[model samples]
Target: MVAEEAEVLVVGAGLAGLRCAGVVAAAGRDVRVWEAGDEVGGRIRTDVVDGFRCDRGFQVLNPAYPELARSVDIANLRLQHFGAGVGVRREDDAVILAHPLRRPTRVPGMLAKRAVRPSDVVALVRWAYPALRPSALTANTGGDTTLLAALDDAGLRGELRRVVDRFLAGVLLDDGGSTSNAFALLLVRMFALGVPALPAAGMQALPRQLAGRLGDRVSTTRRVVEVSRDSAGWRVTAEDGAVARARHVVVATDTRAAAALAGTDPVPTHGVVTDWWASDREWPGPPMLFVDGRSGSRGPVVNTAVISAAAPTYAPAGRHLVQASALWGPGRPEPAETQMRAHAAEILGVDAGGWQPVIRHVVRDALPAQPPPLRTRRPNRAGAGLWVCGDHRDTASIQGALVSGRRTGAAVLRALG
Candidate 1:
């Protein structure tokens, strides 16, 4: 029996689902969004503790994504900007190297560390010049090679290579050696060209803003248990025995969930764990990212930062919010809470022994594996009137999620017309 009819039904009210629904709704079509959880924003969630806003895991928004402006309100996000460079701790020394364009003053610091020698600087310019061409920056130079091989082809070695490998180990949550060269290059381009920021309230502000536009149209606690084709077009059933029928149904859930609901093989993914703590240390310079070169760090933390530096609102009036993260796999070391703080201290040379540990989040399917030969835009249509869209269908970032939504929405629109 048909429970209700919708012009378009979006399963999962994450960024992808919200984006797809927003697009269809803007065209004056009836759209409904069903979210299983008590709230929207999926992995992008923020918790308010004792008047301080702490994100579940450390994440940033990149303004360099071309699709962002078309999908969401830029000014309303009220983003908080992070410094344009990374601080590397190699052995006993700690040094910073900012992007020349973003932190001209810190260029000398990059040079001081020899992260990029004078000749390497010229090569770097040659490497980055193509980003000026909008088409060149947007186009994908297809490749099925590993990122390490791409670095070799680009002639990026020495300190540049060292820091990049170290940095990406944290970002990609892998050794950075096995990632797709094409995807890695795209990520590099985004990093070099984009401004990283966080929403004033927290990362959740982004999805919450999008969900607010739908008002009552987005329903939480309605877990979609099954997806099937019907005479009407498609049928999505909730665990509670309710149903939503529509001419087109988009499964915008995560890769694993989507695969399960669609009866497809689950994709490989990377698990990540992060711990947040409160510290009372002196200023650690700018709100820049800190990476461990693995030159002899004594802990599992590969990257850490006082995120409150990037966004003052993240912490209450005078408290500093610290976050540390690492990629997880077999043989991975997960030190206890105290050890994590000590490890962070060893990397930053800050004594965090007195800092208070607040929260720790572990996501088993945090990021979908992006191997070489990536199809940035995967086919969204599962069958007639059935579709799927998520970060797994594209690059593993907010850009990918929104882009998938846009593409799915466009495909649905063309089909209906």
Candidate 2:
């Protein structure tokens, strides 16, 4: 095998790449990362406007993100927790799903409301049991079933579907049919850990902090044009004709980008558009809401949240920030902004006509459509010295991305040793 120069080279500067770079660099290996964009953080993007901090889309840190918490010093960041009760808006009436932290005994009362049917409550109880049981819930077993399939009764299925769709709009980013039951259960488990929290500065703070830690080891705007293997290692050609040979190469971009770079037959992946808004009014409460089972004039709008509403730092004093996201299925037609605004106003009670959202951004490929078995995923190790890491390769979420990156880094370190 032709020997390569550097110990490791990581592609993409998203969460996965950052984690991989941090690990390999800390291990004293010669690690370098190439990012296509001018900045890192990949999909975990945040923007600040008019004193309001808005994320590319609404993002919540699962207090249960084990690898993320361990890898980074998140406690030092300005983080705030969600309110004890999460509101569910359906047919314009708000139903509260109170967390255990707020009112321990009132959970039963909240569950008994008309918004959540008795059957739905029973299904929740059954589902919660396995999660509560030790050894049943773990990383590997998280995405095993679809949320709809887990419930035995039709009534329970319908109720929970509405509750989840309307309240936790962005939770799955998939239609009811496509969402995994196990993943939904895992989200419920996150609720037990702590309501979703946000960093004081913004979501981008997390990635910026990670990049800062890596220092000069990371490079930006260096698009990797092609990746080919040599006898000993791999050869990575940049768009500018610059070449880098490495003992190991980690592809940590999204599945689509990774497939493109690796020359694999691209698979069909769904795309989404996320719009962020900054408002002057203080959000009535925390921004975590579920918008399920509501009939909209423009068909079904999946999930919506007020990110800045969840914490004071997200927006300037007396102002709040909101992110409304719509997941378009593969081949699904894109809805107009007017349609989205109308739906958001109707479901979220935000006066779309009156409120002028200060900052707006859209993501074409928000996340891959997560189907059961996640067959389109590529293994972390692709070839002799080429490795892959991304949320799509494992569970499709922030935690999954971190885990994949850490595992790939470990594997490369071992192979080099």
Candidate 3:
């Protein structure tokens, strides 16, 4: 078969690959992208199950992502925002700790329940205030430590501390608090600045919009089996014997695949299992995330939410969508169906046994591990004409993926010139 030719070739049509293609294409370069999956959106995919839109895993699109404005139309996605608060399940009842600015009405209740103590508030501010600065995420100038140590050092061993820990477990997929404190604080800053939301269509809408920008440049189901350097730059061989030759190649696949194709060390990863359920009963709770905050209680389910309450489009008329997530990886056995339901029931203060199970997504590589000594910019160039980009190369978030893709694209352009 005749080999395809392009000035730049991007493997994997995830947010990173698609964004890189956009950058190169915008620069008048002939760029092409190949995706191994049957459709775009890589890890950020959604499936319709009995009229419910079940995303591969629990995820949210934060409008505060700085790169989002430069890449996709957030307004066009018609985002349905979650309430600026989190419901914490205690031993007796569920309480909420809300954003002070956005949910001022909830503040009085939070204070009444002692969910936000003065000491805890001061400690949290001391720990996370630096990340609110513009240069905190862009430059790694601060001292680094595990999240636990940072919180403890800042004297945040209160009820609010437990709430932050449980909430971050669902977001970072790291229940151990071993992730970099800086990275975690940066995420908190983003959450404070912008409300996390779901598009009316689904989380996949984000990547779908990016893929649509590239038109036919993205070819799905063309899994590249190998990437090798050639006299002309590099060659990518797909599983079905199709070949693509390019002057520059970017391995923008997931962490494991990128490591294999680019011959780089595979970074550690964390996984999460998310189960979606459909219920006939209306959601009785607010449209926000619910976390297990029973003091020192490490339940099987980290977090869960009445997803349809926040975004009605996720469910069909008269039905509701709910999702529960648990940390899944080494030493962390997947929770049993009974345990997941029980924990979710406790968190939401609702009977979950009658909810119909829609689907369970075991995203084993949900996110690349973000360890301490946060290095926002890892080397993207693997060799002369070889490069790599993904959340693995930067922070483990949508913002990281898009920024890494754009950064790699510019590097390739400079090299080509």
Best by TM-score: 3
| lDDT tens digits, residue span 52-166, model 1 | 6777667888888887888878889898888888877767578777776556676677678666687666655554455455344336545356777766766765666667777
Write the residue-wise lDDT of candidate 2 on 126-198 in tens digits: 6665656434544445445655565543345664555554444366666655565555556666677666788
Q: Candidate 1, overall lDDT?
A: 0.79
Give the C-alpha miss distance for residue 368 in model 1, angstroms: 1.4
In model 3, the runs with Cα more than 4 Å from the true position are 101-109, 134-142
lDDT of each candidate versus the true structure: 0.79, 0.70, 0.89
Top candidate, metric lDDT? 3
Better of 2 and 3 by TM-score: 3
What clash count goes with each model? Answer: 0, 19, 0
In model 2, which range of ten residues has the least summed lDDT? 134-143
How far is each candidate from the true structure, as Cα RMSD in Å? 2.4, 3.5, 1.5
TM-score comparison, 1 vs 2, better candidate: 1
Show where candidate 1 strays beyond 4 Å: 100-109, 112-116, 119-144, 294-297, 330-335
How do the candidates rank by TM-score, highest first? 3, 1, 2
Clashes of 2: 19
Q: Which ten residues in a row have the lowest lDDT in candidate 3?
A: 134-143
Give each model a TM-score. 0.92, 0.88, 0.97
How big is the positional error of residue 221 in model 3, measured in Å on the Cα after superposition? 0.7
